[model samples]
Target: MTTNYKTSFLLPHDYEIPTFNYPQYVLPPVPYNYQPYTQDIWSANVIQPLKTKITAPAQCKFDENKYLNLFSGEFNECYYDFEIDLKEIDPTIQSISKFQDAYKTIEISNLNNLQIKCATPYIENFINDRNVNLTYGNDNCEFDDGLLSNITLKKEGISQTDDINFENTITLYTNNIKVNDIETKYAIAYTNGLPSGDYSNDYITKTKSNVDFLLQVTKLSNNDNDKIKETYLQVYYTNDVKLKIRFSKVLVAKLIRMFGYLYWGNDKNIVIDINNSDTLGIKNNSDDPVKIKIKPR
Candidate 1:
């Protein structure tokens, strides 16, 4: 006869393990959204947003280089460096991106606006045919001023909030930008490990605007031609008038090195363009370097 006593098991049947929902952190070694582009920098047709940090020594905010951004003025910005694990996409892409350069994006708004720029590592040689909406997917968000702060990626598995090092997460630089009639607020993103594009704005700046753009370029730098006796060019601009330029049906971008002129038209057309440099050469001009200040007529 078998005793009908309940079999005592090593484990209790009534007690069950609690379920813990782990927050999925998109750390490295994750799938990457691969953006395809040409591999050449010269022939590539890409117009990436310019960097606040002038990379070209030959050109500055004051100077004119078709390869540089003359309209990019001084503003508060930051850079976020990240590494992507793209082995699944391409075996060659590791730690850094396939291309070493940082991909960049910029968004502009009035003082009421917070300009946001997003960047990914990419080759400048790309066709806008398949423009990468450098946006995030998996609960992923697009690049913006507050993006980094919202998404905090610390260590693998589960990481405590305190473990994150803010300093290492981002590098910040704040400058006092003089605001006048219209204060332009900007947010810039500079990141590698994804994809990038290029403005290649040299003597004349090239942008992604499909309409005629009018911007006033002001010379914030003194024509000192520093101790090195080397002349550097720098300038700034306003975005309010660009719309008018577009409506006028005159789509032309020009960087004038000549002299200034006065316009009599009611629609002043403050943004003016004149001559193109015959020589990219730096001239040993006046003892006081010439800094051209552009304003509305």
Candidate 2:
């Protein structure tokens, strides 16, 4: 079955089909105030998906003559924030030369007892102690330049076999040294990168092959006299793993039905797992009964 197409499905619906491979990551938990370290030289850039506000067309029964009756309160309207999937992007890299004019500097607190990992290539004479004081980028060089000699550096060239690509990893580290009573910790990953000549921080191209879904709660339907009192969505996956569906925006929906298109096939049961969410509770929120659509893009 094709796995790169757009299709729509109704929630509270059921289907059975073969399962295919999808990307999975075991994310590490971070503190609320924690920020990731960042540099500009690495090719591993984070992609931010774009979002376009969409108003779903009315799907319930409405007056045919007035056309104004579409807004006559026959149906409840719900707005949802949606995102574009990264799978649709054409992957490419910005040339290394693009960052030649840029430099990233990070302050290392507790420098006396910490190790650091730097991503850029080393220039032998970038730092010299010939002058009493020196400066490079944002950091002031007060300690003797000889301190760099204590750093442990390693390099691994890119590997390819039979014209096929293999794992390519580059890393650097340093030994803890004290200078001017300042302590330095290692540089980790960061959320932003230096300005790109061809790319912007607003959007990102995929660096990995994993596919991600951008879903939105689009339309809510209430056709019965009894309102749906309490409603929440549960997403199920392989091995019965599930997650409660929540949107970034505040949305009011009942039996919500999301509508959108996908590039993949509609025959797969895993595609509709979001529809058959396990019941969160037996309690109903609204006395009115409606069907809400959960659309995935």
Candidate 3:
């Protein structure tokens, strides 16, 4: 009892909890009006995403704004040209006389690489006997009526000239017994690349989906059976990010269709209505894409 020591211990006590007040979040003001979207604002925010995704995939992020910026940028248009030649010849008088007794033959070389084909009912009366004393006339030997029997073409071994590139050649041929009476003419058709069906599935569409870009032909607005000299091509893309990203898939598909007809030697320039039914739904998903499909306006 004399050695008892004093002991003290701490005890738990209850206290009122403190109240917390969180500040309200405020969204930043958008630079443009938020309403029925205009082409100007939408272009800055939407369709651009589609193009950026397809054009530069590695540099693209899922962010709508950056994609839109890429989409809004301009695209380079492809141009190409093709050259053709026609040659004429006359066989020896003895060859023509011998042909009367047999099926006369005329051979044309230098045509193995072109898409050349002749029309129906080839012309006749191309050969005459030496005793007939018939005078050959240039007007009588026209290429427009030939049957186009055989054709061949070879790529001209040369580099690109003045932004002018060689695509492929097209040759037309026919064999007339009257070789001396035949004449030939060369016809050339020109083009300003091919048309862009839609920009949705374009290479850039995956990154910049929401943009609404348009390709306009501002010059050479007529292709109705006339020679085309020069034409203008204009590209329109949106600048908005959110809109661009949201519609990336659709935009990619559209862009693929938009330039479906662009090739090396398509020199036709005419009023092509973007809303034509035949011009719709031309794009599809594929590992490798190619532009094919020629349309007449």
Candidate 3 lDDT over 184-211, as tens digits, reads: 2222222332232231211212212122
Query: TM-score of each candidate?
Result: 0.13, 0.12, 0.16
Tens digit per residue, CA lDDT, model 1, 1-297: 877867766676678878899999986786544343211111122122321221111121222231212223222221111112223224443422232222121111111111122211111211112122211111222222121112222211110010111111111111222212122322212111111212112121111111111111111125311121111111111232110000000011221222111110111112221211111111112132211111111
Candidate lDDT scores, in order, read 0.20, 0.19, 0.20
The candidate, 1 or 2, that scores higher on TM-score is: 1
- Candidate 3 lDDT score relative to the true structure: 0.20
Predicted candidate 2 versus true structure: per-residue lDDT over 25-108, tens digit per residue: 878988333122332211121111111222223223222231211112232211111122211211221221211112122221
* By TM-score: ranked, best first: 3, 1, 2
RMSD of each: 27.0, 38.6, 33.8
lDDT of 3 at 144: 22
Evaluate residue 64 in candidate 1 and report its C-alpha lDDT on the 0 to 100 scale. Answer: 23
After superposing candidate 3 on the true structure, give the runs of residues whose Cα lies further than 4 Å from its correct spot.
1-57, 61-67, 80-82, 86-210, 219-297
- For candidate 3, report its TM-score: 0.16
